[model samples]
Target chain A: MAMSDLYREHILDHYENPRHHGTLADADFSHEESNPLCGDHVRIDVKLSEDKTRIADAAFSGEGCIISQAATSMLLESVMGWRIDDVEQLDPQHVLSLIGVPLTANRVKCALLGLKVLKTGIKLWKLQQMQHSA
Target chain B: MHTQREFFDVHAVRRDFPILQQRVNGKPLVFLDSAASSQKPLPVLEAMERVYREAYANVHRGVYALSEAATAAYDEARAKIARFIGAPAVENIVFTRNATEALNLLAYAYARAFLREGDEILLTELEHHANFVPWMVLARERNVTLKFIPLTPEGLLDLDAFERLLTERTRIVTFAHVSNVLGTITDPAPIIARAHAAGAIVIVDGSQSVPHMPVNVQAMDCDFLVFSGHKMLGPTGIGVLYGKRALLEAMPPFLTGGDMISYVGFDDVRWNDVPLKFEAGTPAFVEAIGLGAAVDYLSALGMDAVRAHEAQLTAYALERLSEVSGVRIYGPQDPQRRGGVIAFTVNRIHPHDLASLLDQHGIAIRAGHHCAQPLHQRLGVNATARASFYIYTEPSEIDALAEGIEHAKRALRIS
Candidate 1:
């Protein structure tokens, strides 16, 4: 495939001007992950609503390839008002569809890095919540 | 010098490598990842095939004629490699799976046996993971201390810092003869002199250097030198570990099984002699023969000419790359101090993105930490795109790489 096919206009836009591209200071939980193969890193900070049932806001910060940073930007923008449980149920295929590009096996990791960090963060936060309640 | 240059024609050399004569992504393939692993020449490939077809048997085990022939070929390969590196004796060269396995062998057989608590092992920031992680693992298990020789702002090893890091407690000093990422060549003579004065034995990781330049372990006086075959026009699954005669004789075997033992006993085992003691089981005899053929190929070309060719190519690459705006090249600006590897980043483009863009143009370059994460962290960059050269590389390939980078910049919308 040509470079243009992968780095489309929308992907470039998200990469150049990422949405929610910084940490939320009063975030309920945060998690950071790195793709060891390429040294690409992504950290996700999420803030829950007052009722703690839905994600009020989510921001991601990291340095990496265009697909990773842009995918994270696009992912955060799509899931801003998503229910916390629904976000947990988000699968890897959903992330690939969100990327909207055919990726080689190696690059699939780059595109999914954001979702991996976000899902892992939510899982850890849930674990902490359960501990506090107990 | 001009006559030598004329004698070693790169176009003639390029013809020997069959893989270079192909198209990728509808463009002529421009391979720039030789530092990762080089393309094999016809001689090496033919040697391997001839061995499989004519003389195929388990080496050193069979008493039959075919086995003897295979054994003779394997031993001849060892002798060729020994001569290639200026090793004193063929007995000093021990074969392993690759450079990584060679380094691990030393860590297990030497460091685990000799290193004590609080003993310091000095290493450089320029080491690839193959040289670094083994020592790190040893330190954790043996309660040893690991110290690093810092790098200068120009990415060269800080010799002053190296001298300061040397101490009486320093038991081992190991560093790469050349940095895989920066392509900076470290002169081992002075490092070895000082390390010996401090009572530390020096190990040189020659994975990058040996394939590019003339190396003499005897002249350098290093205790151990490790390099892989695949990076030097040989097939995979074969590497060399050259040690001083006494050192190899003294160190216990790292891996033990059938061929390595002189006699196997349930109560006690008598190990075979030095080189054989280290090599166990059915070795990669055919691959070793291929490596022997590779050594012959390089020897025929003359390493001095190979070095001269790469130096000229590197100088030209640096100049061409510099003309492109916003291109930041790593390593020493002077090509004399570096090998033919150029690592760089263009504008704000991520290396992976740039690599993918270049792939569309059929230009292959490495994009990552290059297995030197500590050095990448020191440079304050996650990754860089690297283009490395070898015997068959042409000047037009460099021009193609530079043009490809410009094309990549435009495609990524980077001004």
Candidate 2:
């Protein structure tokens, strides 16, 4: 893999001075994901519409190495205002590919840390929506 | 050091390790993950092969020729290991799957015996999870407090904090003889002295140190020292836990099973002696024999020479990897007290990314927390990439690793 591909300038910028890195007060969905092996952690808070159909806002909070923090920040920017279905729609490989380089199998989980929180939040949203409909 | 003996060629040593000859990204493999598990040597391989091909049978229970031969081989292996660590008898040696299991054995048998509510266990922040987790569980289960000796800024264990932490409540002291991540060699003698004065038993995690240097359990004065065969050019599924004879004789048998029983009756069955009491069911006889052969191989090369060769490679790699612009090494700058392990972060590249690009150049390294989460947390990074050396590792391999890291950084342009 090219070093350039792994360290996109945008990724490093986000890691150095992260964007939207705090709790969203109006958040309806928040999920904490941790990579136990590496100790990477992220608490992703999404401000969802009451109907659970849309993401109104997104923010992240946690401590980790540069890539992990960068990835979470990029995720917040990428997912805001996107439909809940978009997050639920992502495959593991697509999430990995977004990092721009292929990953070794063990490190693949590190790349998926943010995607896991997004999926967990989506699952919670769907469950709440089912309960509301019932 | 003896330099008169015929020097072993790097290519010849590479031939002994079949994995080194294999292709990676269309290049000959450059393995740097020996800290995880060293590649097996021919003698170690042949010893296991002979055990299986010539004499394969259950140990201790069987009375026939094959069983007796296998049992004798296994017992002989124990004797060699006891001598290897300067222990007085084979009774002090209990076999386990790996260093982790050996540590858990002590946790179940010894730690459970004395630890109770309000007591404290002293451990160093440099412990691998294998050493740290077992004691943590004991602390939580018995309501015992677990404390750590904080690390210096250079990543060595802080001797001052260690001295201050010793008190009447402390029952046990455990720490790594060598940090698997930091590559820092720790001197446990003073801590052992203090713990002994406080009436605390000490456990030394020798998983890394035993492979790189000579380990004399008697000289170290540790109650228990655990090491893995896989990290020493021997097979997996076999390891050694050297406990003091009196200590082993006193502790309860952890796992109760067939081989561990003295005899069985409808109402009562007594446990066997020290090593047998702890060894339950069929042991890894082949692996044990292989480990004995590994001891012989390392002995033939001499541990002092192995230590010297590894130290040279480490210093060279550290110097070259640091040459990369914006690269940061987390451990000590001095090579004198450190082992061959080197952990670092590149300009702005993730360790996983560095590992992948290194793979393209047939260079292999370990990435992530390396199973020492607390150390990583203390260092304020989630993960770091590591390169560790062994007897078979060469200066050329270190150069390849440096070139690969530089290429990886330049390709990504993280700076």
Candidate 3:
């Protein structure tokens, strides 16, 4: 039972003190998702650029397992300056690689919770944009 | 059959479950999740296999030799289960898919048939979704109101609030005999007496209580009680709903099909007797036979001895788990009021993480809300890790759980 295979030092560091782990007071777009079986919740709030093409700032707030929370913090760090389209292309495998561990089938949902929130937030942001134009 | 002396012996009991001998994650398997679903003993498995191999046929409709043999086997199982639970007669026991289906049957046939608008249904905060949801549906459809007995901070039922909630309008009161998550063994005698005095019928979800304790439906004086076979070392897809025969006789059939009918006309029909009227189709006779074997195994061990074994194990687990810094236990701390199940949360370690870590040590435990979301909400925690004991569980497993928690804290870099 090599615990290091799952909880490496960097993963623990991020889990102990998550980065950008707070709610944006006035976010342009936000989304929340939860793993009902494990009760792992993840919410992402993003401030889009004026041109609406790039993410100007992103923050997250939720309580979950170390893998979920740390992966969320890492995910928040990776998408700060990315184009909305590239962020949308992020998939479960990409999140797996970001966490750098082989999660069992059950725990895959925990590692991917953050990415789900981000993708959902992007869709909501686009929806809000459409409503604003109208 | 296990010898009476060997019955209380944990080592001998462990040998009965073949699954316990295997290794998981390079460590000896430590099964601590019996409360979720118990592992089958050799006898239970052999009994089901015997039925399928030798006496396989649909029950009641067949008149041939094999069919009669099958029917006899199935009927005998019902009688055994009835005697095991101290029901008045075999006619009072109805077989359903599982305890969930059993609860749904009572809700539809009994509660839906009898209750009316402005009536009230009282439930507790600790009900599993199976027990809680059906009544909620009944309440909505019949224009009735549903009230809850608030949970005390100690994770026991608030009996004071329960008294206040019971009114003349209360037609039914349903709750768990033992909470699946809290492991709190609620004494239902008071509740049953009070509900009966208030003209309300009582339904006990004995899914948790029936497996670990000696249950006598007549002595309890409840109108109905339900439990699943899978949780008691039998096969899945089989459960028992024990009701007073008169109540079962009065309620309309929940499901209508080939087997449950006594006679039929083009537009009108005559249903079967007490239990069969509720059992609609070809019931799981094979699984029911398996459940009978499970009952035999438990009876041979003696329920009083089983209860004592779990009490000893639970006390040891509580004492051992408390030694782990920052581990907060749920339910009554006193072993007298709790069963073998222990639900706890370690500081800075989510239950999911802790469960996974324990898995690495070949220790199986349950994490999350355990299908009691309302209870979790009331407890103000998203989830908690649970380690439950069975006859096969030993004190050494609790030590493994404690070590697993320490290892998890270290891996997570928590103090």
DockQ of each: 0.80, 0.42, 0.78
Candidate number with the higher TM-score (2 or 3): 3
**Best by DockQ, which number?**
1
Worst 10 residues of 2 chain B by lDDT: B1-10
Model 2 residue runs over 4 Å out of place are: A1-23, A60-102, A124-134, B1-9
TM-score of chain A of each: 0.97, 0.84, 0.93
Better of 1 and 3 by lDDT: 1
Q: lDDT for each of the candidates?
A: 0.92, 0.84, 0.90
Candidate 3 local lDDT, B1-415, one digit each (tens): 1112333767887788999999999999999999999999999999999988998988897799889999999999999999998998999999999999999998898888899899999999999999888988888888999999998888899999999999999999999998888899999888999999999999999999899999998888999999999999999999999999889999999999988989999999999998899988889999999999999999998999898888888888888899999999999999989988999999878999998888989999999999999999988999999999988987778888999899888877787
lDDT of 2 by residue, B1-415 (tens): 1132223455666677776778787877888999999999888988999988999988887789999999999999999989888898889899999999999998899889867889888998878999989888887788889999999998888888888998899988999888999998987677788899999999999999999888888887999999999999989999989998898989998989889989889999999988899999999989999999999988887888788778777777778878778778988878878899999988667687678778878888988899998888799777899999987787778778888877876666554
lDDT of 1 by residue, B97-144 (tens): 999999999999999988999999999998899999999999999899
Q: What's the TM for model 3?
A: 0.96
Off by over 4 Å in 3: A125-134, B1-7
Overlapping backbone residue pairs in candidate 1 total 0
Candidate 2 Cα deviation (angstroms), residue A115: 2.2
**Alpha-carbon lDDT of model 3:** 0.90
| Inter-residue clash pairs, candidate 2 | A3-B411, A3-B412, A4-B411, A4-B412
